[model samples]
Target: MGGPDVLATWSTGEHTGAALDGKSLTFPTYRKGTGPGVIVIHEIPGLTPQVVAFAEEVVAAGFTVVLPHLFGTPGKGLSPASLATAFRQVCVRREFTKLATGTTSPVAGWLRSLARDLHDELGGPGVGALGMCFTGGFALAMMVEDTTVAPVLCQPSVPFAVTPGRSRDLGLSPADLDRVKERAAGGCQVLGLQFAKDPMTGRRFDTLERELGEAFLRVDFPGMKHGTVTIDRQQEGVDRVLGFFAEKLH
Candidate 1:
């Protein structure tokens, strides 16, 4: 199916100084109604048109959505090489490995702060998070605090280590996993979505479900491909995601 049209657009500003590591991180936000807060973390390609559109859909659902431009400003899209370079840059400056391990990374902290600010601004006690592709596991890490996080992992990446010692490269660390397990045991529910054929996220789903037990809820779209689920669009998988989030966060 085709993606939805751009519903609306609003200007979001850039961050200066050490907070943004001297790079400008600015992104546009498309909103609808307002109530709870939901943070949408984009894929490695950065915030694409589809990603922003998804945020718009969340807004339509009566939740205020924020899509942070972890990469940088809009217009210039990153090629594969540039993408890798950007990620490495973020890693070197932000120590992303530490963030994945349950300690907040620079970007993760920004997300948490944004969520909290949005929750307060929107007048809610909690908020939801959605992470995709390279960011999928980050949402899980955001849930460690629980006070502001209710997360949805869509096609999460970086969980299954390709080589020895690679597990450390995942966004959620062992300590974070332990915390997630504890939270799950105590009644928190963590949901995941993936395409059955998407090799990148398929293994992650298996690993996380086994590790998270009942706290993990996974929905596999038998014929869907990666990036198929966009915001406010109608698709079986998208419907399932909305339903899942509605049940868990609404």
Candidate 2:
């Protein structure tokens, strides 16, 4: 988990907590000069130092940033070691249908609720959601509640898991996708980012981008791997995100 200094302390305020999904969600929040609300959803590895640094960068751009610990509390954060191991196992476990089918899980509901709470706290009509990796599509799901909830689905997964029973759980129901399309037609933009080498996100980015049309802003970082966006906040993608939020939310 060690890496370069991607964040300056002055960029953000402090880390805080909120109750969500029966867990004490620890978030690295920044609220200095207010403009728009931004909710940062962490990858499967949970809210690591890298992710918090990215949230800080967002705050520096003049937005209220909330990095929710969708997994759990601070120290209880997901272990990178274990996550890496699990990812490896998934790669080898050919019978891991559970992993794919688990896409229709209830995680999206919790995220949507948190977005609502953040909107309430920020005193805005709605807020923006940024989801990465495992939770990437959650942002899109949040938009199902309202089009005003601009979402950035960074490296979304589980596209082939679409089914009637698991649709709502996995953040892809017919009605929800239809609503998102409608929003896009009306002018809501959904952005996505992925490393060119990350097979998990790269494969579906183009397809989803095509399906989403003008609403989808797809960016690829050549030679970069999975989880690099947060790992390298100084990168152009990160900067674009900051600027995008500053412009859209403000």
| Best of the candidates, lDDT | 1
Give a tens-digit lDDT track for model 2, residues 1-250: 4322333332443433332234433335333335677888777656566677677677777777766544423322347674775456435532212244323334555556666666767765578888887777778777766624568877665443244333223346566667777887877888778777765653566555666786788788776566656654438788777767756776
Q: What is the C-alpha local distance difference test score of each model?
A: 0.62, 0.61
- Model 1, stretches more than 4 Å misplaced? 1-8, 14-32, 72-95, 98-106, 159-161, 164-170, 228-234
Question: Please, what are the lDDT tens digits per residue for candidate 1 over residues 105-199?
Answer: 44555565566666667765578888887777778777776754467888765534454333434465466668777887887787777777766
Error of 2 at 33 (Å): 7.4
- In candidate 2, residue 30 scores what lDDT? 30
Off by more than 4 A, model 2: 1-34, 72-104, 159-171, 232-234
TM-score of each: 0.75, 0.72
Clashing pairs in 2: 104-169, 104-170
